[model samples]
Target: MLKHAPSSAWFRSALPVLVAWFSLSAGACGLYSLPPLEEQKARILSDQITLRALTAQAFLEAWGEPTYSHSEPMQFFPVASGNYIPRFRVPLGESPPGWDDSIVSEQALFLGYADRGELLGFLEKRLIYREHLPAEQIHAIAAQWKREELFKTRLEAPPARPPSP
Candidate 1:
């Protein structure tokens, strides 16, 4: 007995058109990109990260720990609002319509300061120079902190060796 071929004439035509639609739809969403570490610095520095503006605790709470990405202040979504829209001005520019709706979650890479504000580092996007330090660096920092916990006071001048007569 010969098996009948399934009716795919409609499917064949719809598939390519559907694929094209999807491609166009994706392009509308904008290209997906994660910025490089160097660029990350530039990006954050462009935003500005300062010691006074952001504390270690603010970063820790925002991120998980003070990694290269934690030095800067990150505005995460689901609750990312720009500085509480003042009581007198019309919401314009950065606070555009659905500004909060656009973002998902933002994790920042740590970078130096710009002027006085908190710098929001770039998302490392480079293929070759995706600068991610080894886990040991993070581990070593933690280990050093643990050792410091044992310290109570400064060492007393290392026994003061006498000079030769």
Candidate 2:
């Protein structure tokens, strides 16, 4: 007696099940796993060289839009002044007589990403500093942002009219 081979229809039905089983097993083996968000954030932050090189646009693409942003004005004296004097002063005859001790204002942008527990500072569109806060601090910052947003909305809303009699 001759044994009959499995029909094409049988193979077709089994193919999907086989594929799903393999997919699930691969996932269970961690082959498809991704690092935790916190770990990823830590890794990204640890790369200071890359972080410092990132421009504001690149940072926005990598970290997404910040929850809140603010501009800070920074002032600095370009020339030596006060108690801090230069050890070797420039020859008075060689250079201009008076020192140009003008206060220069720099525009810095502070981006706060509460969800990622990060605060990034950018000067002239270039990243200057980054801070990663703990979960508790992140939560507090998120709460403060929410409160500020609510207050801003309330202030911007039109005054309520008295109900008609």
Candidate 1 overall lDDT versus native: 0.36
Q: Taking the tens digit of each residue's C-alpha lDDT, what string does model 2 give over 1-165?
A: 759988999999999999999985664233553444454445456653233345566556557788767653544222322111121123333432343554335655667777787766655564545657765665665566457556756555546899999
Deviation in angstroms for 54 in model 1?
A: 24
- Report, for every candidate in turn, its global Cα lDDT versus the true structure: 0.36, 0.54
The TM-score obtained by model 2 is 0.37
- Model 1 per-residue lDDT tens digits across residues 47-130: 443211333333343334443332122342221223211111123344433344434223334422222222233322211101
lDDT of 2: 0.54
Off by over 4 Å in 2: 1-51, 75-105, 135-165
Per-model TM-score, in order, reads 0.23, 0.37
